[model samples]
Target chain A: MPSPAGTPDADPVRASAGAPAADRAGGPAGEPLIEVRDLTRVYRRPRTSLTRPGEAVHALKGVSLTVHRGERFGIVGESGSGKSTLLRLLCALDRPTSGSVTFAGREVAGLPERSLRFLRRSLQIVFQDPMSSLDPRMRVRDLVAEPLVALGEPVGDRVAELLDAVGLPASAAERYPHQFSGGQRQRIAIARALAPRPEVLVADEPVSALDVSVRGQILNLLADLADELGLTLVFVSHDLAVVRHLCETVAVVHDGLIVETGPVDDVWEAPGHPYTRALLAAVPTLEGML
Target chain B: MLTVDGLGVRAGDLELVREVSFGIGPGERVGLIGESGSGKSLTALALMGLLPDGVTASGTARLGGRDLVGVPERRLKDLRGRTVSMVFQEPMTALNPLMRVGAQVAEVMTLHGVAAGRARERAAELLGRVRLPDPERIARSYPHQLSGGQRQRVMLAIALANEPDLLICDEPTTALDVTVQKQMLELIAEVAPALLFITHDLAVVASLCERVLVMYGGRVVESGPLREVFKHPRHRYTEGLLAASRLPPRGTRLATIPGSVPAAGRFPGGCVFRDRCAHATETCETAPELTAPELTAPDLTGPEPRGDGHAFACWHPRR
Candidate 1:
């Protein structure tokens, strides 16, 4: 189904069509920006002793979902539910053990390094912890400029514009990330991610490491940017309220599988799956306090 | 019961916590809420006489007629595990990786001079009390062998082993998943006689505590019963925080406080929160006293009694 209510720009397509519909619905109106079909990832731990063979972990158990262009899609799960694994595969950063991931109607799996460069430019990621992701010694200007510089794009005035767009001062570009607070450091990360001018942004618990007061600022910045640029967004978080606030459609991951998927309000107001109901109940909200 | 008055913590020339005063009645649960650098944790540390070097606490904090602040370290040691105990946020670090879970819980009892033989048996019982299934097996496992929830339960068992009159938890569930956090919160409430919970999650506080204290810029900005403070927050900072925590409908902008929390000792000399508070006026140039304006005589006859139990430290509080 098309994204209901707020996300009016969501391209319409068959809700549960098993096969790729890119050619069937050629225009952006029906073509999904990102699609995953039966994606699976298996990690094998080497045998430490000769007597033991090895250990195998099925991180993702054949998960499938489609994210339409300009749609704010969310994946919610507790730790080790394969949300991270799915995100890595969807971004083409890691190969799936089996299944297919298509970005803009092109297969993401087994792409050549040269073709993969295009995927890197089109899809960007903002990690959870900014301190670890950002280089401590590098100045903010060089960090935001790294993406453009690597892509061989001109660096003229783009850094200043990016800093301004992310609500950071122009002078901030000269300071190291260590000089900034957690919130400011995250803003810098967001600016860096946007430097490539990507169509899709995937954030994995972007605000979880931030303080309560600063969480709003970062989430608002992301929401504002997503709307202004019409960017397709994939937000992965365990926070039900946060996912409900930011996304139009949500897929609840449990036991390495998508247990439920629907409009955010539909799932929140009337969850059909047991795990989704439990997750929604566990999240304490301001309305509950009242 | 515990009572604190005019508690302040300072490091050399910098004051990190100022004029914090609250009490935990017997069997009562009180929450100290704020963002990072707001001194909520420091306040708990000061209560337990566990401040790091170079930090000095000034003010009177008495537990059951005995002074906690300014007490000699020797005397504080005697009262620590027996009178007041604390559970830190990180369960993995809080536990000793080298020791088995039972040994760790029994260690607290043995350190307090419980009979060695009795301590071992009591340790297993304490683990069972925290609702861990098959406490005997869990007691034999190492800290790393247990899941995050199981490790936290061990922490709770250790904290409650001596049955201290007061239990101080500093962001105890911040590291756990939502489902695990819910169970942990419930277990703490069930076991602790008097809890002083410090956390940044307002919803967690609302669910767990009966009373609330809002802190900002090293000061207590508001204090009241949980229902009263949450339903009708007087301080502008509390109002902003409550609004910021809510999940607005899709496409709505979250209401954010104007600026980030000020650095410790860097707050304005007058009102610490005035820089971010939109209600600030000329009068706010001077620090406002924390007073309970709504508190009058209680309506004992009414079904839900009303009294002047709420206090806020804002010159221009919300009506």
Candidate 2:
């Protein structure tokens, strides 16, 4: 389906034809937008006894990967698999205990908040639950424009433009978040993320909370927007099928480590890791079995 | 073993579910598929006479020749665990945090008239039947100490303690990981004599069920053998749902339904799905009856034939 608005002509960062061709051929040839190396994060559990140290939990262990510009990279893992920890480190939301994360050849491992304005403008995240992520007290227009306002950018007609791009009516801007349906609320969340025109879009289980029918709408919207803007997508989900639909590269994380990484189709056709095989076999599919 | 006809649930003047009818024979496995606000869970709750306060049920729901609607609470309580048991979506909430897992399973049996000593012994056996590792050790652990899958297994053990004739599972595996969910589904299929599986996942239903009922706006808009419905869906809603469930080619757009599900009690008067269906006409403003359509292909009836043919409710249907 075409985007609700006419073709987005305002943005000049459309995908270069060679980028997707290279991605389809197995690997991305574009420059690395984000590079991670030997990343590890450890957390201390709460102490249960007096005068005793809390147990140390290794959430991530020596994980390393590269996300190329204009590439769709998927991270698949179950809950508590340290996939969230990896995403947090990639986005610089959490500090890693070891290793380094570099964005466009600059280290972002432990930078202060004030010095990370460029990183903030280059990446945006859409969380799992739209209801929890979007502020309930704000109107749709202000919520969509909040990112731009925070970055000291002029809030022009970008709100209406984004609403159209995500297939929402202009009338929706006047209403509160509670007035919209779950899918509409998600569209609002996507619009809010795109307001500042970030080069990289990170979605964490974005459609997991939506209904079965509406999930396709959101996925299609994400794919369409990513292509139109040439934005690098770092999508994380537990379902391989969903990731396969949107991403070219896949990384299967299990127990704080990357168990498998390759082209999504190759991994889906023949998984090397036993955990990936088990995960693939367990996903209920309506293939010939129906 | 279970037959529901004209089942409707209402709170005050608003009807949330309307004209839901289906049946499950002995040893038959059926799936009730719907999105949120589709009234699938309410229908299961109505079957067990376990609807919440301010909500009441209508019409006849015969469970083993006994009407469940309007049944006395005392009698319903007696029939619940013994005749028909239910497993909810969240095992953590369904289980008692204060009680040990073994005691919870044993309590269901003792409440259904099994002796306390014999019930305790059977509870462990039931846990083992569900394939929970170290059943004896698991029995002594509280709900908080167990993982989500283990807790779900404990819930299954309790549901099967009295060996009910029919089991109603409402999204029992929705909150679980894929591997754990597969094991749980296998365990349920092995132990449940008859099942009314309710879930939004069409693939999960296609994997475990022989017959399927598609519910929309609290109504069973379509019903038939799983293979027939999945392959040749006549209802617009079912066709859209199946298309949406399939993964599209990478980088291509997925087929999507036009609108979101309406809020409970806010669905239109006639066709519940017409608002979202693209082929809706003025005739769709009037409700269509559920009827078996003439098929050019051979009818693929389910193994435990309930006698109902492939049926759909639509003024205009895909050929």
Note the DockQ of each predicted structure: 0.41, 0.41
| Model 2 agreement with the true structure over B1-319: per-residue lDDT tens digits | 6878789999999898888877899998999998988999999999989899999999988888877898899889988988899999999899989999999999999888889999989998999998887899999999998888888889888888888889999999999888778888888888998999999999999989988999999888889878888999999999999999999779678998988999987788789898999999999999998885334345535442333467899999888
Q: Candidate 2, residues A132-217: lDDT per residue as tens digits?
A: 99999999999999999999999999999999999999999999999999899999999999999999999999999888899999
Q: What is the interface RMSD of each candidate, in Å?
A: 6.6, 9.1
Lowest-lDDT window of 10 residues in candidate 1 chain B?
B299-308
RMSD, model 2, all Cα superposed?
A: 7.6
Report the error of model 2 at residue B283, Å: 1.3
Among all windows of 10 consecutive residues in model 2 chain A, the one with the lowest summed lDDT is A1-10
The TM-score each candidate achieves on chain A is 0.89, 0.90
Q: Candidate 1, residues B1-319: lDDT per residue as tens digits?
A: 5888899999999999999888788898999999998999999999999999999999999999999999899999888888899999999999999999999999999888999889999999999999988999999999998888888899989999999999999999888878778888889999998999999999999999988999998899998888889999999999999989887888888888877876777788778898888888889989988884354236423221221278899888888
Which regions of candidate 2 are displaced past 4 Å? Answer: A1-25, B293-307
